[model samples]
Target: MTKIAVLGAGSWGTALANTAAENGHDVRLWTHNLNQVEEINQQHTNSKYLPHATLVDTLVATNDMFLAIENVEIVLSVVPTKAVREVAKKLATALEEQAHTVILAHATKGLEQGSYKRISEMIAEEVPEAYRSALVVISGPSHAEDVIKHDLTAVSIGSSDESAAKLLQKALSNETFRAYTNHDLLGSELFAALKNIVAIASGALIGLGYGVNAQAALLTRSLVEMRDLGAAMGAKPETLYELAGIGDLIVTGMSPNSRNYRAGLGLGKGKSLQQVTEEMGMVIEGVNTTKAVYDFSKMYHVDMPITSAVYQVLYENKPLRTAVADLMARPLKSED
Candidate 1:
């Protein structure tokens, strides 16, 4: 059995920790919340996050970063995008001597704000040389809600190091869960991050009472937007055609389980961005990602109309219907 360290006790992090523990790994989850650590260790349930699911008894919890990473073979992080560098820095400090022996992987999906770097890149910058293994990105269509239910799920493990990716596959996969390796780290990470923006669009469309036809149109057009932005950012074209891209977009964009989608739902109902953020009680990653990608696209000279629309609605205070009208009113273009 492998020893795994999971940073962050949020929904996604706890679900993944549960999966690892269920797979017979010695899993230790670290969080800043002392109350949550107590709950996970004593009650075997993260009531706030995964109230419906019972975590395995073997899964442990800690508030101490040192204890979490001690002697672990792999460190898997599912923290929010904003916390990637902070968490990676903490891990580097805590890993000390063990850094060279452990594999570092993150399921966090979002780009950094100023640099617009993928989660893997941010982690690499902060944790460089501290980890001997290439940072691996574990992402795709899976949701923490369904994952805790042991419903069938599949995800892509993207790493430049093939062996590190396979090791993560062995450590995490089971009968109900599977991880496929994709060497296209950029593509896997890109689609995973950008799809949340489209998901927000998806939720907003539904909340605004748009029917399936609108949903269909949004998905198709956003896929084009995602691919175009990815190409300008150096992603492999084939990777965007795979599970990490198309598959992930379908699930997140359509599901109520997505926090980004839920946030958009509130926005579509004419709620203020601040109001929706307060109500959700979780980080809506797409909010920040939309801003980052909007800037990134301008830098790359890519025309990202859908992203721009979402950005306008969220940041510029553009009315939802007005943004929709703007998109529809754009000059006609050939679908090449």
Candidate 2:
């Protein structure tokens, strides 16, 4: 069985570790929280994150960062986007001899603000350059809650190296869990990061009591805008229509469990962004990705009207209805 190191104890991380263990892989699920480590090791559960879920008996959890990376061939990074670089750096220092020994697969789905660097870029900066070529990103419409329940899911795996992607495809795929491989790492990552912004916009529409038509229009337009921006940024145009883009957009925007969409709902219901974020108690990725998209659009000179309007509503205290009106009033352009 493959040895897997999951570098997070959140719901997604726990779910993936459980999946690996159930597939008969040895997993060392690492968390910064010692109490969570104890919960997984002693009780075989992560009640805080996955309340109704049970961990596989072979799954181990630990707070010792070094122990988590020891002799593992696959390092699955499931931490938040903001913490990715810091965690990767720590992993690098802790596993110097094993630097190029393990394959790093990350599932974070947001861009770095100001720099607009994707998670893979951040991982490349933190990990040794020799090992950077082995970095991979796994993304799709799968939600942590659903995945923990073993619900059927399809995910995409992308990497610069075709062999690495194929390896992950074999390691993570099952009859219920389907995996597809692509060499368009940048496109996959770009879609994963940008889809969150569209989800926020979709959520805002729902919160405003707008009907399905408006949500559908916003989602379609936002996706086209994402492709336009991704094209300018060297991504494959066709990738935006695939799982990482359209697939993730549909699920995250419409699903009630999406924290990003829920945060937008609160904003649409007249709650301040600060209040919504404070209540969520988790990182609403779209909030952070909004700023990233705003900056990236300017950097790429792509006209993303919806993203701009959503950002203004969230960050500039612009009223949601007013922003919608502004977007609607913009000059019409050819739908080329």
Candidate 3:
């Protein structure tokens, strides 16, 4: 059995850890919360994050960061975007003297707030070559709640190192869980980050009482935006349309299970950003990614109107309906 260390205990992290454990892997699910360590060990449930979901008995949880990674074959980084650097730095210290390189697979999706760097870039900055053989991104439409239930889930795993992706693919795939290996690492990561913005826009439109037609339009147009931006940023064309891009976008935007979509819904229903966040009690990737993508668009001259609208609604206090109006009134261009 492969030894797997999951560096986070949130819903997604816990769910993934459970999957590896059920597959008979030696898995260590780590969380900074000591109380969480006790809960997962004694109760096999993470009520704080996945109240309705039950974890496997073998999926052990830990509070000690170093212990989790000791002699593990795979390290899954599932923490939020803000914690990526801190976690990597700590892991680097832990793996400093390690002779063997561990595969670093990140499921966290979003860009750094100011620099707009992706999670892999952040991990590379802190976790040097001696620690990790490669950085793999495991991302797609899979939701934590559904995954824990063993509902059919398909995800794309991409890495600069193809062998690492294949290794992780075999480690993660099962009857209910399917993983496809991808070579377009940049495209996979770019769409994974940008799609959250579209989800916010989708949720906002729905919250504003718009119908399915509007959602169809938003999905289509926002895809164009995602594609154009990804293209300019060196993403592969097909990757933007594959499971990592459109697949994830559809699920996150359509499902109420998505925190980013729910956040947009709250804003659309006239709740302030603070109120929405306080109500959700979790980090909404779209909210943070919105600001980063908005800034990156300007700096790179990528035209992203919907993302700008989301930024305005979330940060500038622009009315949801007003933002929608502005989008509808934008000068029409060729669909090419």
The numbered model that scores best in TM-score is 3
1-336 per-residue lDDT for model 2 (tens digits): 888899999988888888878888888999999888888999998987788888788999998878998888889999998899889988888778655467888988888866778998888888886654488998889888899888999988988888888877777787778888887889989888888887777777888899799988888888778888989999887777788778888888778677888888887778888888898888888888888888888988999998899889877988899999999999888888
Estimate, for each residue in 1-336, the C-alpha lDDT of model 3 and write its tens digit.
Answer: 899999999999999899989988999998999999999999999999999777899988998878898999899999999999999888888888555579999999898888889999999999888778888999899999999999999999988789999988888889999999899888888899998998888888888899889988999889988987887889999998789999999999888999998988888788888999999999998888989888878877988898899899888988889989999999988988
Tell me each candidate's TM-score. Answer: 0.97, 0.96, 0.98
Cα RMSD for candidates in order:
1.2, 1.4, 1.1
TM-score winner between 2 and 3, please give it: 3
For model 3, which pairs clash? none
Q: What is the C-alpha local distance difference test score of candidate 2? A: 0.85
Sequence-dependent TM-score of model 2: 0.96
In model 2, how large is the Cα lDDT of residue 265?
Answer: 81
Ranked candidates, highest lDDT first: 3, 1, 2
Which 10 consecutive positions of candidate 2 have the poorest summed lDDT? 93-102
Evaluate all candidate structures by whole-model CA lDDT and list the values in order.
0.89, 0.85, 0.90
